[model samples]
Target: MLVLFLLGTSSSALAKGQKHTYWHLTSDAGEEAGKEFESQLRSVLVQAEGTHHTTEGSLAELLDQKPLKVPSCFEGAKLCTTVPELLVEALGVDGLVEGRISAAADGYQVELTLYREFGGTPKVVTRSGADLEGVVRDAVGALFTLEAAIKIYTEPAGASVFVNGNLVGESPTRVQVHEGNHGLRLEKEGYEVLREDLTVLPGEVREYNATLVPKVTQITVITWAESAAVYVDGKLSGASGAPIDVMPGAHSLELRANGYRPIEITFDIAAAQRRTIQLAMLKEVEDPWARREQAIRTYRLYVEAGYALTLQSIGFAGATADIAGSTYSPTSFGGEDRASLVFNGVKLAVGYTMERLGLVFLGVDLMVASMDSELILTAQDTARRESAVGQGASHIALYPLQGTFRELWGAFGAEAQTGLGVSFDSLNGDLTGDAFDLSQTAVFWSLAASGRYYLSEEWSLTLGYRMDYDFADQRGLRHGFFAGVGFNLPLLVDAGGESKDESLPEQLEEDVPVEGTDVPESTLQKLEQSGTEGGREP
Candidate 1:
């Protein structure tokens, strides 16, 4: 016979003990083993489906627009008296057909319905009674509902990224979530914040590699840039410092500068990590400031080799003129070193820099020639001797601006040095007799002003004009330009956490380290004396 013991459903996912909305059990067997079966079956079904008891009196009030928030099901919540009517509604039909078969037999069936007070119908599906325990066990495993792993990617490589208040990667648009429910968020500077709920599963790797349209959010950071645009996960985010929200995760960041070229980069993201976007632009001749700052320990030490166009010209009278009606034309010539190169063979520089009180550097530059040119002059008494003219070559030293120098938008350096040079020809036509040694160990003084722009951190070029007077009394001009390739051997000085004050009674004031005054006691005292000599210094 088709036995129908009891059938019911509720408006709430939870209820309190006997007060829970449900169909009371009754059958031809009266209230014997039938009651026991009903109790056992309800216990299993409610627990598995995450519907238990509610302490509230009104079921309708308890199951309003939302389910009651409960402890993590991972703790094995006991849901004996109530089951959500929503699950019952999911059957598509009207009610739920359920029953309990003796475990010693096969499976059981349970009948469940919704709004049965108005005679709602129920549907039936059959399964083993033992399977109920497994369903409950699996449902109570993980936390944060079911989530699937999210898989993300970007185009043109590196894109700044974040996910769910956590930083997973600098360029990874991908992530993971479980089945059930989740909150997903994505961000990159210059782009708008993107977010949505994510229903995930174990095998799913959700993709977030869509091009981010740029946005002009609540930030305005304009420094220097070129073809320079921003992107996050294949999307155009905005220009540098364009505010945008990001999920917590790993992501990539790229900064493009003007030129026939662009720049790209990658980095990590984590809670508490700085999320500011900025780009400092410069000529496309050397390293980008962003990259150079990473390896350069000392600014002056970074210049390894350079090329330039320099013009050194001097016009003189008083010497090549006769008291005649016309000026003498004794080899009249004036030209500039249109191009030249210099390589720093021996360079030394060092400094200590902190974010606070500015920066100070001390260094000297020693450069020998890679290529250079010069002019010379001489005189011969009344005789047609052509005098002795010297050529400047090799064995030279130059000192670039160091210590406290001038302040100009351009590069300026003072030059004064000693070197050995040699010249040929113009020794009064005396092909012999020291004529070849005319350009010998001479003193040369030069004052120069130059301009430079960098395309990247690795390469740069300069334009300079120098006026040099050699000891030969014959002064001529030479000018040229050169390209610079830089190499940096960095000495990293990571400030350790300020040493804590461990030596005192809490009432005593702690001694703070003085700025620019890191030295041994003796050295400090010596510096103090020097300061005393100069009134004071910070």
Candidate 2:
């Protein structure tokens, strides 16, 4: 008959108890007596909440099938001294209890050995009494439970601790534990859960300490862009303004904005480590029209000096010497004379650009240009005298006024300038037989266009074309091309007294170490100093 007993304990509490299982090996006692002793031991184990198994097969059958080789006895008689490990393996149990009955001064003697399945010697228990059944039952009941004491603590002092999936009191406390292997866990809000496996020894007190790491890691991402989206690995995290958590490892970071080229950076961080990163996104170059509009918004101050070659010709009306008193006609100048009109000159300009007004810049430019030209003239029919109307011409001087509009596209640029000003001209040559000087000052206007390529951030090479027309008509037109370099100076202040780029926040502040953290003090200080320095610099 199957018997059941009720021990008034909660099922969960019973289930939480340490589990023990053992096999009862056939004893060397008389078969009837050994069977009776095993039955009594089995009843005791069940009362202790342990599960037990007994083999019904013959000993010869069990020994033949077990994989372990049997040690030979000297006479080849089947070795009666049982190897407990072999019996335990044959029955597939955690441990085995084997007993032998023998003659003694008392009515009988029962010798029992508990062999745990793992490595080590067996535990021997002996009982000498009038009845063997009572002694075996008493010996088997005491071996079911092994007890030890364990004290656990954490750095932060209040972490909830657990053993074998059952919560104990908060850490920094000691608890009685069942021996063998068990799982230990410590947990708290805002900290990583720490789980470990521990082996306990019976009648021993063990001490354990754990340092909990933060569950969230703080990482500050900084960029020179406003409202730019940030990406960690491949997923979009947030915009440019806040600090966020990122997994500690190598990751591809990207910054994206409407008019700026997306910036990509690769970075790494350690576990529980804090850091700051700075990103600089470049402006995307668009069509020339858009570039021109952008350049007008912010331009710099510069001084440019270059060499120019002008092709110019002068025309004059001379009095005819027929029978009339001063009849004038236009003089016809030939190719050689036109060749002599070509002049080499130098140009220097200094200018300041004001704040942009819409798409145009309002500013003034003072420019100086000089050229020397030879002119040839003759009087008709009569011998000309110095006191009479002059006969030949010589040199001329000119001055011009201009305004400028400039645009930059990455490393390349273009400019167009037009304005009106005044010019002073002096002409000198020989009249008939002597030297002569003739001079005039006239109003003039000029137009110029230039293409520039920057060789560096502040220096550029330029090619230009210019035309100056004299309003008096006689001076004709002076037009030519030039090549030169230009440079810019950074000012201490702008139209708003400060550059907009300077107002952007630099490196973000480093994450501060939490109180009671296990991070080294020197490391935290180093991170703080590095963040301060980065924020101060570009």
Candidate 3:
């Protein structure tokens, strides 16, 4: 008896498109086993119908040969058992089976060899038995099986597939293969390539379903403003018009345009995602000069006209003559024992200031007011009143401290000013029915402050309070509030629009030698380009 054991059976032995035609040949020996064993072995080989069976007789006829030497399929090699190439070509078969039965002490010894002509070693079995057919049946059963069909599919169809680096077909395809590990690869444009190792068993129908992730994501850049440049991670990509393909992750994006503030944002994009983002651009706030420089640069010229109220008083003392033996006190000169009156006035001022010089200003204030005061005299026991009326003009030198806050297109500011100047005035007075000159001229000073709200680029409304004091003896303080309108004189001084200062640093002539030192051409060019001219000439 012959025992046959298979280490394993590979269904891929019948891999799709693999050659399967096999020819079987046999020779018998032993007295009683001769014809019966040959017949039994042929029946057993036929049981492997999954492989296309070709009889020895048919193969010999196809090659036009008679009494074909079955051992020639092994190329006359002993113990080496691959089918000869020429024999396979002549018969057009993938493999062949050769069997022999010889006399043994137990009645018969049988040997069978299975040869795959394409490549690889052969399978062989030998047995000593009186029952040769049983051995052949077991051998065939252990060596062959139905191939497994592998079905491959992808989420997006039409991906090319490869098995062991050999192109198989597009996905949604089925391939019959022997049961074993097979290297699989799926490839598609714009999607991540896939690779895997697969194993299948005999008669099994295996299925592979895969969803491939995209390699890039779709990113659309949108902005409310036009002509904005788009950047990805600080690199300029293009203008904000179309969608951009980017790798999936957090990416820094920037949008910028002229006259608009730039914006930066970060985004996380997933694979195969379509996302739209809106970027807002805002107009930049323009300041031509620095805050401290603005007042000196533009706000120094103005014309002011407003109303003012003044409080006036005079002190005089006199004694009544002894015509009737009556006396009068100085405080009693005015009928009410006081000489004080409130007067209303109009004031106009025109001035220019140099803020760089600590906001110093030169201006003339013209002021006119009706001044009135009374004096009472008691002479011969009679009481009387005296009054005066006058007006004045003042020339002032002002130094103010200023501050500003910006609004839409303009600004609001306030200034506190202290000024010293000269005041000249004329008054006529009647003292107890006698006319006399009540005129005076003297230096005066004022403490003033104003709040200004600019309505436009060059015009403003001003509310101011001022207290004025004259140095003349017996003169009282004139203090009041004023409201005015002011204008900026652009022709007098150019308050330039928003611009960047490009002037460069300069070295003082005092720091340089009287005879100029040698300077490199590059340094000179830089100085000239930077608009800095300094130092003594050679």
Give the TM-scores of the predictions, in the order they appear. 0.22, 0.35, 0.40
Model 3 per-residue lDDT tens digits across residues 1-538:
2211111123223356554544344444643565676566545543354554433234433344424554553432222233344465444457655666777887667776666665567677777765565555555546665455679999889999998898899989988777688899999876899999999765456799999777867777665356679899999877765788777778998888765467787888876677776554443433432322343345456666666565555433232222224444333423544345554555666665443222334444444434354444444355642232222222222223322232222266666667576665544444444444333456667777777776654677878787877766666676777777777664334355344333433221111111113444444444344443331111
1-538 per-residue lDDT for model 2 (tens digits): 1111222332223234444343434444466665666566554454444544443323344355557665553122132345647545543446655656655676556776777766478888777777655565556545655356788989878999998888989989987777678899998865789999998765346899888876666567665456789888889887876886886667887778864567677777765667676654443444444433334334566666677776655553222322224222334333232222555555566555433311112222222323233333433444332222233333333323345676556667787877775655443443334555445555667777889786654566879897878776556787888777677554334343322232223333333322221434553344344332222222
lDDT winner between 1 and 3, please give it.
Answer: 3
TM-score head-to-head 1 vs 3, winner: 3
Score each candidate by Cα lDDT: 0.36, 0.55, 0.55
lDDT tens readout by residue for model 1, 120-202: 34333333344543322232222112234566665434555555566666555555544456665566664556665666543
The positional error of residue 312 in candidate 1, measured at the CA in angstroms, is: 4.1
Give the clashing pairs for model 2. 394-428, 395-428
Candidate that beats the other on lDDT, 1 or 2, i.e. the better one: 2
| Error of model 1, residue 247, in angstroms | 28
lDDT value for candidate 1?
0.36
Ranking by TM-score, best first?
A: 3, 2, 1
Clashes per candidate, residues 3 or more apart or on different chains: 90, 2, 11
